[model samples]
Target: MSAAPFTVLIPARLASTRLPGKPLADIAGLPMVVRVARQAAQSAATQVVVAADDARIVQACAAHGVTALLTRTDHASGSDRLAQACDLLALPDEAIVVNVQGDEPLVAPALIDAVAALLRARPEASMGTAAHAIDSWQDFISPHVVKVVLDAQGLAHYFSRAPIPHARDQAEGQAWWQQAPLQRLAPLRHIGLYSYRAGFLRRFPQLAAAPTEQLEQLEQLRALWHGHAIAVHVTQQAPAAGVDTPQDLERVRALLGHG
Candidate 1:
Protein backbone atom coordinates (compact mmCIF):
# COMPACT_ATOMS: atom_id res chain seq x y z
CA MET A 1 0.00 0.00 0.00
CA SER A 2 1.08 3.52 -0.77
CA ALA A 3 1.92 5.92 2.00
CA ALA A 4 -0.57 8.71 2.66
CA PRO A 5 -0.13 12.07 4.32
CA PHE A 6 -1.50 12.14 7.89
CA THR A 7 -2.10 14.73 10.61
CA VAL A 8 -2.05 14.17 14.38
CA LEU A 9 -4.69 15.80 16.58
CA ILE A 10 -4.32 15.63 20.36
CA PRO A 11 -7.56 16.15 22.25
CA ALA A 12 -7.14 17.99 25.55
CA ARG A 13 -9.90 18.27 28.12
CA LEU A 14 -9.40 20.20 31.35
CA ALA A 15 -11.86 18.37 33.58
CA SER A 16 -10.46 14.90 34.16
CA THR A 17 -12.13 12.82 36.85
CA ARG A 18 -8.95 11.58 38.49
CA LEU A 19 -6.75 14.53 37.64
CA PRO A 20 -8.61 17.78 37.12
CA GLY A 21 -6.99 20.37 34.85
CA LYS A 22 -4.97 17.51 33.48
CA PRO A 23 -4.10 19.08 30.12
CA LEU A 24 -2.47 22.01 31.88
CA ALA A 25 -0.77 19.87 34.51
CA ASP A 26 2.96 20.49 34.49
CA ILE A 27 5.19 17.75 33.20
CA ALA A 28 8.90 18.53 33.03
CA GLY A 29 8.04 22.28 33.18
CA LEU A 30 5.80 22.11 30.09
CA PRO A 31 2.06 21.51 30.32
CA MET A 32 0.89 17.92 29.76
CA VAL A 33 -0.82 18.70 26.47
CA VAL A 34 2.27 20.46 25.18
CA ARG A 35 4.40 17.47 26.09
CA VAL A 36 2.01 15.20 24.19
CA ALA A 37 2.10 17.52 21.16
CA ARG A 38 5.87 17.55 21.25
CA GLN A 39 5.93 13.75 21.22
CA ALA A 40 3.48 13.65 18.29
CA ALA A 41 5.58 16.22 16.43
CA GLN A 42 8.28 13.56 16.35
CA SER A 43 5.91 11.41 14.28
CA ALA A 44 5.55 11.43 10.48
CA ALA A 45 2.33 13.50 10.74
CA THR A 46 2.31 16.39 8.28
CA GLN A 47 0.96 18.58 11.08
CA VAL A 48 0.29 18.16 14.82
CA VAL A 49 -2.45 20.22 16.48
CA VAL A 50 -3.92 20.11 19.95
CA ALA A 51 -7.73 20.08 19.86
CA ALA A 52 -8.07 21.91 23.14
CA ASP A 53 -11.35 22.35 25.00
CA ASP A 54 -10.06 25.14 27.22
CA ALA A 55 -8.41 28.47 26.47
CA ARG A 56 -5.76 27.73 29.09
CA ILE A 57 -4.78 24.63 27.09
CA VAL A 58 -4.45 26.69 23.88
CA GLN A 59 -2.39 29.27 25.72
CA ALA A 60 -0.08 26.57 27.05
CA CYS A 61 0.32 25.20 23.52
CA ALA A 62 1.20 28.66 22.22
CA ALA A 63 3.78 29.14 24.98
CA HIS A 64 5.33 25.83 23.99
CA GLY A 65 5.26 26.66 20.24
CA VAL A 66 2.72 23.95 19.51
CA THR A 67 -0.29 24.66 17.27
CA ALA A 68 -3.57 24.45 19.12
CA LEU A 69 -7.19 25.37 18.32
CA LEU A 70 -9.99 25.97 20.82
CA THR A 71 -12.86 23.54 20.40
CA ARG A 72 -16.31 23.32 21.96
CA THR A 73 -16.35 22.31 25.61
CA ASP A 74 -19.12 19.75 25.27
CA HIS A 75 -17.64 17.23 22.89
CA ALA A 76 -18.66 13.75 24.08
CA SER A 77 -15.43 12.09 23.02
CA GLY A 78 -11.96 12.78 21.65
CA SER A 79 -13.18 11.59 18.26
CA ASP A 80 -15.80 14.32 18.32
CA ARG A 81 -13.18 16.95 19.10
CA LEU A 82 -11.08 15.57 16.21
CA ALA A 83 -14.05 15.93 13.84
CA GLN A 84 -14.40 19.56 14.78
CA ALA A 85 -10.68 20.04 14.31
CA CYS A 86 -10.90 18.41 10.89
CA ASP A 87 -13.71 20.78 9.90
CA LEU A 88 -11.84 23.82 11.21
CA LEU A 89 -8.76 22.84 9.23
CA ALA A 90 -10.79 21.95 6.11
CA LEU A 91 -9.09 18.59 5.70
CA PRO A 92 -9.95 16.66 2.54
CA ASP A 93 -12.05 13.49 2.67
CA GLU A 94 -9.07 11.22 2.03
CA ALA A 95 -6.83 12.79 4.64
CA ILE A 96 -5.85 10.56 7.55
CA VAL A 97 -6.30 11.93 11.08
CA VAL A 98 -4.75 10.32 14.16
CA ASN A 99 -6.31 11.08 17.56
CA VAL A 100 -3.57 11.01 20.16
CA GLN A 101 -4.71 11.56 23.73
CA GLY A 102 -3.21 14.52 25.58
CA ASP A 103 -2.17 12.40 28.53
CA GLU A 104 0.08 10.13 26.47
CA PRO A 105 3.29 12.15 26.71
CA LEU A 106 5.34 8.98 26.48
CA VAL A 107 3.60 7.55 23.41
CA ALA A 108 5.92 6.22 20.72
CA PRO A 109 6.06 8.02 17.37
CA ALA A 110 6.30 4.71 15.50
CA LEU A 111 2.93 3.56 16.91
CA ILE A 112 1.33 6.73 15.55
CA ASP A 113 2.73 6.07 12.08
CA ALA A 114 1.82 2.39 12.23
CA VAL A 115 -1.89 3.01 12.89
CA ALA A 116 -2.09 5.53 10.05
CA ALA A 117 -0.37 3.09 7.73
CA LEU A 118 -2.79 0.37 8.81
CA LEU A 119 -5.73 2.50 7.73
CA ARG A 120 -4.06 3.34 4.45
CA ALA A 121 -3.42 -0.32 3.70
CA ARG A 122 -7.02 -1.30 4.34
CA PRO A 123 -9.25 0.86 2.21
CA GLU A 124 -12.29 -1.03 3.48
CA ALA A 125 -11.58 -0.05 7.09
CA SER A 126 -13.03 3.23 8.32
CA MET A 127 -10.53 3.52 11.16
CA GLY A 128 -7.58 1.79 12.79
CA THR A 129 -6.10 1.36 16.28
CA ALA A 130 -3.28 -0.57 17.93
CA ALA A 131 -3.24 -3.31 20.58
CA HIS A 132 -0.74 -5.58 22.28
CA ALA A 133 -1.07 -8.92 24.02
CA ILE A 134 -2.05 -8.86 27.70
CA ASP A 135 0.99 -10.01 29.66
CA SER A 136 -0.37 -9.69 33.21
CA TRP A 137 -3.43 -11.15 34.86
CA GLN A 138 -4.12 -7.84 36.60
CA ASP A 139 -4.34 -6.05 33.24
CA PHE A 140 -6.49 -8.76 31.71
CA ILE A 141 -8.96 -8.69 34.60
CA SER A 142 -8.94 -4.98 35.30
CA PRO A 143 -12.18 -3.33 34.15
CA HIS A 144 -10.32 -0.09 33.48
CA VAL A 145 -8.17 -1.84 30.89
CA VAL A 146 -10.34 -2.36 27.82
CA LYS A 147 -9.74 -5.56 25.87
CA VAL A 148 -10.33 -6.29 22.20
CA VAL A 149 -10.99 -9.57 20.37
CA LEU A 150 -9.89 -9.61 16.74
CA ASP A 151 -11.06 -11.71 13.83
CA ALA A 152 -8.84 -13.70 11.43
CA GLN A 153 -8.38 -10.64 9.22
CA GLY A 154 -7.26 -8.44 12.17
CA LEU A 155 -10.58 -6.64 12.31
CA ALA A 156 -11.86 -6.19 15.86
CA HIS A 157 -14.75 -8.55 16.63
CA TYR A 158 -15.62 -6.89 19.94
CA PHE A 159 -14.27 -4.62 22.66
CA SER A 160 -15.19 -5.11 26.30
CA ARG A 161 -14.23 -4.34 29.88
CA ALA A 162 -14.77 -7.96 30.87
CA PRO A 163 -12.09 -10.64 30.50
CA ILE A 164 -12.80 -12.21 27.13
CA PRO A 165 -11.97 -15.40 25.21
CA HIS A 166 -12.30 -17.15 28.55
CA ALA A 167 -10.08 -20.12 29.20
CA ARG A 168 -13.01 -22.13 30.52
CA ASP A 169 -10.95 -25.20 31.27
CA GLN A 170 -8.49 -23.28 33.39
CA ALA A 171 -11.05 -21.22 35.29
CA GLU A 172 -10.42 -22.95 38.63
CA GLY A 173 -7.03 -21.44 39.56
CA GLN A 174 -3.89 -19.49 38.61
CA ALA A 175 -3.39 -21.66 35.52
CA TRP A 176 -5.58 -19.53 33.22
CA TRP A 177 -2.89 -16.93 32.75
CA GLN A 178 -0.40 -19.55 31.64
CA GLN A 179 -2.87 -21.59 29.62
CA ALA A 180 -4.31 -18.60 27.80
CA PRO A 181 -1.12 -17.62 26.06
CA LEU A 182 -0.88 -14.84 23.50
CA GLN A 183 -2.10 -16.50 20.35
CA ARG A 184 -3.78 -15.15 17.22
CA LEU A 185 -7.17 -15.26 18.96
CA ALA A 186 -5.99 -14.33 22.46
CA PRO A 187 -7.33 -11.18 24.09
CA LEU A 188 -5.40 -7.94 23.62
CA ARG A 189 -5.40 -4.79 25.71
CA HIS A 190 -6.68 -2.03 23.44
CA ILE A 191 -4.44 0.96 23.00
CA GLY A 192 -6.56 4.13 22.98
CA LEU A 193 -4.84 5.77 20.00
CA TYR A 194 -6.88 5.91 16.79
CA SER A 195 -6.50 6.78 13.10
CA TYR A 196 -9.51 7.76 11.03
CA ARG A 197 -10.23 8.96 7.53
CA ALA A 198 -11.38 12.58 7.68
CA GLY A 199 -14.65 11.69 5.98
CA PHE A 200 -15.49 8.82 8.33
CA LEU A 201 -14.53 10.88 11.36
CA ARG A 202 -16.94 13.61 10.34
CA ARG A 203 -19.73 11.05 10.10
CA PHE A 204 -18.81 9.07 13.22
CA PRO A 205 -20.97 11.06 15.61
CA GLN A 206 -23.97 10.65 13.33
CA LEU A 207 -23.97 6.93 14.03
CA ALA A 208 -26.17 6.54 17.09
CA ALA A 209 -24.43 5.04 20.09
CA ALA A 210 -24.99 1.32 20.32
CA PRO A 211 -26.21 -0.48 23.44
CA THR A 212 -22.91 -2.26 23.87
CA GLU A 213 -21.03 1.01 23.42
CA GLN A 214 -23.01 2.56 26.25
CA LEU A 215 -22.61 -0.48 28.48
CA GLU A 216 -18.90 -0.87 27.90
CA GLN A 217 -18.26 2.87 27.55
CA LEU A 218 -16.26 2.13 24.42
CA GLU A 219 -17.07 4.44 21.49
CA GLN A 220 -15.52 2.14 18.89
CA LEU A 221 -18.56 -0.04 19.32
CA ARG A 222 -20.68 2.60 17.62
CA ALA A 223 -18.60 2.20 14.48
CA LEU A 224 -19.04 -1.56 14.51
CA TRP A 225 -22.76 -1.18 15.11
CA HIS A 226 -22.89 0.90 11.94
CA GLY A 227 -21.10 -1.91 10.10
CA HIS A 228 -17.79 -0.08 9.88
CA ALA A 229 -14.69 -2.24 10.03
CA ILE A 230 -11.94 -0.99 12.35
CA ALA A 231 -8.55 -2.48 11.50
CA VAL A 232 -6.61 -3.71 14.53
CA HIS A 233 -2.84 -3.36 14.27
CA VAL A 234 -1.32 -5.86 16.68
CA THR A 235 2.05 -4.66 17.91
CA GLN A 236 4.43 -6.67 20.05
CA GLN A 237 5.83 -3.59 21.73
CA ALA A 238 3.77 -2.45 24.69
CA PRO A 239 3.29 1.32 24.91
CA ALA A 240 3.90 3.29 28.05
CA ALA A 241 0.66 3.68 29.98
CA GLY A 242 -1.10 7.05 29.78
CA VAL A 243 -1.60 9.24 32.87
CA ASP A 244 -5.12 9.28 34.25
CA THR A 245 -4.79 9.98 37.98
CA PRO A 246 -2.74 11.91 40.54
CA GLN A 247 -0.47 8.90 41.11
CA ASP A 248 -0.09 8.51 37.37
CA LEU A 249 0.86 12.20 37.08
CA GLU A 250 3.49 11.83 39.78
CA ARG A 251 4.87 8.73 38.06
CA VAL A 252 5.15 10.60 34.77
CA ARG A 253 6.76 13.58 36.50
CA ALA A 254 9.28 11.27 38.14
CA LEU A 255 10.06 9.71 34.79
CA LEU A 256 10.67 13.12 33.15
CA GLY A 257 12.07 14.79 36.32
CA HIS A 258 10.26 17.77 37.86
CA GLY A 259 10.87 21.05 36.06
Candidate 2:
Protein backbone atom coordinates (compact mmCIF):
# COMPACT_ATOMS: atom_id res chain seq x y z
CA MET A 1 0.00 0.00 0.00
CA SER A 2 1.16 3.56 -0.71
CA ALA A 3 1.82 5.96 2.16
CA ALA A 4 -1.47 7.54 3.27
CA PRO A 5 -1.61 11.32 3.53
CA PHE A 6 -1.44 12.64 7.11
CA THR A 7 -2.57 15.72 9.02
CA VAL A 8 -1.59 16.95 12.46
CA LEU A 9 -4.33 17.90 14.92
CA ILE A 10 -3.63 19.68 18.21
CA PRO A 11 -6.50 19.57 20.70
CA ALA A 12 -6.80 22.74 22.77
CA ARG A 13 -9.25 23.03 25.63
CA LEU A 14 -9.48 26.41 27.37
CA ALA A 15 -10.89 25.29 30.72
CA SER A 16 -7.95 23.33 32.03
CA THR A 17 -8.19 22.56 35.75
CA ARG A 18 -4.45 22.95 36.37
CA LEU A 19 -3.99 25.97 34.12
CA PRO A 20 -7.03 27.78 32.78
CA GLY A 21 -6.81 28.99 29.18
CA LYS A 22 -3.81 26.75 28.76
CA PRO A 23 -4.02 26.64 24.96
CA LEU A 24 -3.76 30.42 24.80
CA ALA A 25 -1.08 30.65 27.48
CA ASP A 26 1.87 32.68 26.30
CA ILE A 27 5.44 31.47 25.93
CA ALA A 28 7.91 33.90 24.42
CA GLY A 29 4.92 36.10 23.46
CA LEU A 30 3.34 33.31 21.40
CA PRO A 31 0.23 31.32 22.29
CA MET A 32 1.07 27.79 23.33
CA VAL A 33 -1.31 26.28 20.72
CA VAL A 34 0.30 28.36 17.99
CA ARG A 35 3.70 27.13 19.07
CA VAL A 36 2.55 23.51 18.88
CA ALA A 37 0.93 24.05 15.48
CA ARG A 38 4.13 25.66 14.20
CA GLN A 39 6.14 22.66 15.41
CA ALA A 40 3.71 20.21 13.77
CA ALA A 41 4.03 22.12 10.50
CA GLN A 42 7.71 21.23 10.43
CA SER A 43 6.77 17.55 10.29
CA ALA A 44 5.87 15.43 7.22
CA ALA A 45 2.16 16.03 7.81
CA THR A 46 0.33 17.64 4.90
CA GLN A 47 -1.37 20.16 7.20
CA VAL A 48 -1.48 21.24 10.87
CA VAL A 49 -4.78 22.28 12.47
CA VAL A 50 -5.63 23.31 16.00
CA ALA A 51 -8.87 21.66 17.20
CA ALA A 52 -9.74 24.27 19.78
CA ASP A 53 -12.67 24.51 22.19
CA ASP A 54 -12.57 28.28 22.49
CA ALA A 55 -12.67 31.23 20.13
CA ARG A 56 -9.63 32.86 21.73
CA ILE A 57 -7.57 29.83 20.78
CA VAL A 58 -8.87 30.12 17.20
CA GLN A 59 -7.97 33.81 17.10
CA ALA A 60 -4.59 33.10 18.64
CA CYS A 61 -3.79 30.56 15.93
CA ALA A 62 -5.23 32.83 13.27
CA ALA A 63 -2.80 35.58 14.27
CA HIS A 64 0.07 33.16 13.76
CA GLY A 65 -1.27 31.89 10.40
CA VAL A 66 -2.07 28.48 11.90
CA THR A 67 -5.33 26.74 11.01
CA ALA A 68 -7.65 26.48 14.01
CA LEU A 69 -11.11 24.91 14.00
CA LEU A 70 -13.51 25.41 16.91
CA THR A 71 -14.71 22.06 18.20
CA ARG A 72 -17.30 20.94 20.72
CA THR A 73 -16.39 21.78 24.34
CA ASP A 74 -18.19 18.68 25.64
CA HIS A 75 -15.82 16.17 24.03
CA ALA A 76 -14.25 14.21 26.85
CA SER A 77 -10.81 13.69 25.24
CA GLY A 78 -8.42 15.01 22.64
CA SER A 79 -9.12 12.08 20.36
CA ASP A 80 -12.80 13.05 20.32
CA ARG A 81 -11.91 16.60 19.36
CA LEU A 82 -9.71 15.33 16.57
CA ALA A 83 -12.54 13.12 15.37
CA GLN A 84 -14.72 16.17 15.00
CA ALA A 85 -11.84 17.90 13.27
CA CYS A 86 -11.65 15.07 10.75
CA ASP A 87 -15.33 15.58 10.02
CA LEU A 88 -14.85 19.33 9.62
CA LEU A 89 -11.89 18.85 7.31
CA ALA A 90 -13.73 16.11 5.36
CA LEU A 91 -10.81 13.72 5.74
CA PRO A 92 -11.36 10.24 4.31
CA ASP A 93 -11.34 7.20 6.59
CA GLU A 94 -7.94 6.17 5.22
CA ALA A 95 -6.42 9.56 6.01
CA ILE A 96 -3.99 9.66 8.93
CA VAL A 97 -4.40 12.10 11.80
CA VAL A 98 -1.71 12.67 14.39
CA ASN A 99 -2.90 13.98 17.75
CA VAL A 100 -0.22 16.40 18.92
CA GLN A 101 -1.22 17.91 22.28
CA GLY A 102 -1.70 21.68 22.18
CA ASP A 103 0.39 22.27 25.32
CA GLU A 104 3.38 20.47 23.77
CA PRO A 105 4.96 23.54 22.22
CA LEU A 106 8.37 21.88 22.06
CA VAL A 107 7.15 18.60 20.47
CA ALA A 108 9.71 17.33 17.95
CA PRO A 109 8.81 17.16 14.28
CA ALA A 110 10.73 13.92 13.92
CA LEU A 111 8.69 12.30 16.69
CA ILE A 112 5.49 13.32 14.91
CA ASP A 113 6.74 11.76 11.67
CA ALA A 114 7.91 8.66 13.51
CA VAL A 115 4.47 7.93 14.94
CA ALA A 116 2.71 8.53 11.63
CA ALA A 117 5.24 6.36 9.85
CA LEU A 118 4.76 3.61 12.40
CA LEU A 119 1.05 3.50 11.61
CA ARG A 120 1.79 3.53 7.92
CA ALA A 121 4.21 0.64 8.23
CA ARG A 122 1.84 -1.46 10.33
CA PRO A 123 -1.27 -1.98 8.27
CA GLU A 124 -2.81 -4.09 11.01
CA ALA A 125 -2.48 -1.27 13.52
CA SER A 126 -5.27 1.28 14.04
CA MET A 127 -3.14 3.64 16.11
CA GLY A 128 0.55 4.47 16.64
CA THR A 129 2.50 6.15 19.47
CA ALA A 130 6.08 6.71 20.53
CA ALA A 131 8.12 5.64 23.56
CA HIS A 132 11.68 5.98 24.88
CA ALA A 133 13.93 4.28 27.40
CA ILE A 134 13.54 5.29 31.04
CA ASP A 135 16.85 6.67 32.36
CA SER A 136 15.75 8.09 35.73
CA TRP A 137 14.57 5.84 38.56
CA GLN A 138 12.25 8.58 39.80
CA ASP A 139 10.40 8.63 36.45
CA PHE A 140 10.15 4.85 36.47
CA ILE A 141 8.28 4.88 39.79
CA SER A 142 6.38 8.13 39.47
CA PRO A 143 2.65 7.59 38.87
CA HIS A 144 2.60 10.77 36.84
CA VAL A 145 4.85 9.18 34.24
CA VAL A 146 2.91 6.65 32.17
CA LYS A 147 4.75 3.44 31.23
CA VAL A 148 4.25 1.07 28.31
CA VAL A 149 5.33 -2.48 27.49
CA LEU A 150 5.67 -3.45 23.82
CA ASP A 151 5.25 -6.85 22.22
CA ALA A 152 7.99 -8.49 20.13
CA GLN A 153 6.39 -6.89 17.06
CA GLY A 154 6.56 -3.40 18.65
CA LEU A 155 2.83 -3.36 19.36
CA ALA A 156 1.74 -1.98 22.74
CA HIS A 157 0.88 -4.78 25.17
CA TYR A 158 -0.11 -2.49 28.01
CA PHE A 159 0.05 1.06 29.42
CA SER A 160 -0.14 2.08 33.06
CA ARG A 161 0.68 4.81 35.55
CA ALA A 162 2.43 2.23 37.72
CA PRO A 163 5.82 0.78 36.77
CA ILE A 164 5.14 -2.06 34.33
CA PRO A 165 7.16 -5.25 33.77
CA HIS A 166 7.98 -4.97 37.47
CA ALA A 167 11.57 -5.81 38.26
CA ARG A 168 10.78 -8.45 40.85
CA ASP A 169 14.42 -9.10 41.75
CA GLN A 170 14.99 -5.40 42.35
CA ALA A 171 12.08 -5.05 44.76
CA GLU A 172 12.95 -3.21 47.97
CA GLY A 173 10.50 -5.04 50.22
CA GLN A 174 7.15 -3.67 48.96
CA ALA A 175 8.59 -1.05 46.62
CA TRP A 176 10.48 -1.62 43.36
CA TRP A 177 13.90 -0.07 43.06
CA GLN A 178 16.61 0.22 40.43
CA GLN A 179 19.78 -0.72 42.34
CA ALA A 180 22.11 0.86 39.82
CA PRO A 181 21.49 4.55 39.19
CA LEU A 182 23.42 4.57 35.91
CA GLN A 183 21.62 1.54 34.47
CA ARG A 184 18.99 2.53 31.89
CA LEU A 185 16.18 0.00 31.96
CA ALA A 186 14.22 -1.53 29.08
CA PRO A 187 10.84 -0.35 30.40
CA LEU A 188 9.62 2.48 28.13
CA ARG A 189 8.11 5.85 28.98
CA HIS A 190 5.01 6.38 26.83
CA ILE A 191 4.91 9.69 25.00
CA GLY A 192 1.45 11.30 24.70
CA LEU A 193 1.79 11.62 20.92
CA TYR A 194 -0.65 9.52 18.83
CA SER A 195 -1.42 8.83 15.18
CA TYR A 196 -4.72 7.25 14.08
CA ARG A 197 -6.39 6.02 10.93
CA ALA A 198 -9.29 8.48 10.61
CA GLY A 199 -12.01 5.81 10.76
CA PHE A 200 -10.75 4.41 14.06
CA LEU A 201 -10.29 7.91 15.46
CA ARG A 202 -13.89 8.71 14.59
CA ARG A 203 -14.97 5.53 16.35
CA PHE A 204 -12.67 6.02 19.39
CA PRO A 205 -15.22 7.94 21.44
CA GLN A 206 -17.71 5.14 21.07
CA LEU A 207 -15.32 2.45 22.28
CA ALA A 208 -16.52 1.45 25.72
CA ALA A 209 -14.26 2.38 28.61
CA ALA A 210 -12.55 -0.61 30.14
CA PRO A 211 -11.79 -1.33 33.81
CA THR A 212 -8.11 -0.58 33.17
CA GLU A 213 -8.97 2.74 31.57
CA GLN A 214 -11.01 3.91 34.58
CA LEU A 215 -8.46 2.56 37.06
CA GLU A 216 -5.46 4.07 35.25
CA GLN A 217 -7.24 7.19 33.93
CA LEU A 218 -5.76 6.42 30.54
CA GLU A 219 -8.03 6.53 27.52
CA GLN A 220 -5.62 4.56 25.35
CA LEU A 221 -6.45 1.47 27.36
CA ARG A 222 -9.86 1.50 25.75
CA ALA A 223 -8.27 0.93 22.35
CA LEU A 224 -6.39 -2.10 23.63
CA TRP A 225 -9.44 -3.42 25.45
CA HIS A 226 -11.31 -3.22 22.14
CA GLY A 227 -8.55 -5.32 20.54
CA HIS A 228 -7.06 -2.64 18.31
CA ALA A 229 -3.33 -2.95 17.81
CA ILE A 230 -1.37 0.19 18.66
CA ALA A 231 2.07 0.26 17.07
CA VAL A 232 4.66 1.90 19.32
CA HIS A 233 7.65 3.62 17.72
CA VAL A 234 10.54 3.42 20.14
CA THR A 235 12.59 6.59 19.81
CA GLN A 236 16.28 7.14 20.60
CA GLN A 237 15.49 10.21 22.75
CA ALA A 238 12.60 11.27 24.95
CA PRO A 239 10.42 14.07 23.65
CA ALA A 240 10.04 17.25 25.73
CA ALA A 241 7.23 17.16 28.27
CA GLY A 242 4.13 19.28 27.73
CA VAL A 243 2.99 22.12 30.05
CA ASP A 244 0.37 20.83 32.49
CA THR A 245 0.67 23.14 35.50
CA PRO A 246 1.85 26.59 36.56
CA GLN A 247 5.35 25.30 37.21
CA ASP A 248 5.36 23.58 33.80
CA LEU A 249 4.33 26.84 32.13
CA GLU A 250 7.10 28.68 33.94
CA ARG A 251 9.63 26.02 32.98
CA VAL A 252 8.56 26.27 29.30
CA ARG A 253 8.81 30.04 29.47
CA ALA A 254 12.31 29.79 30.95
CA LEU A 255 13.31 27.40 28.19
CA LEU A 256 12.03 29.90 25.61
CA GLY A 257 14.15 32.71 27.17
CA HIS A 258 11.10 34.48 28.64
CA GLY A 259 11.44 33.75 32.31
lDDT of 2 at 234: 89
What would the per-residue lDDT of candidate 1 be over residues 165-229, giving only the tens digit for each residue? Answer: 67776653342555435354556999999999999999998789999999989999999988999
Question: Lowest-scoring 10 consecutive residues by lDDT in candidate 1?
Answer: 173-182
lDDT (10s digit) by residue, model 2, range 1-259 = 5455699999999998999988888899998888899889999889999998989889888989999999998998888899999999999999989999988999999999889988779999999999988867678789999999988888999999998768766644333323465244467899999999899999999888999999999999999999999999989987898899999999999999884
The reply for model 1, stretches above 4 Å from the true place, is 173-177, 180-182
Q: Please, what is the TM-score per model?
A: 0.96, 0.93
Collision pairs in model 2: none
- Estimate the overall C-alpha local distance difference test score of candidate 2: 0.89
Candidates in order have lDDT scores of 0.90, 0.89
lDDT score of model 1?
Answer: 0.90
Q: Quick one: best TM-score, which candidate?
A: 1
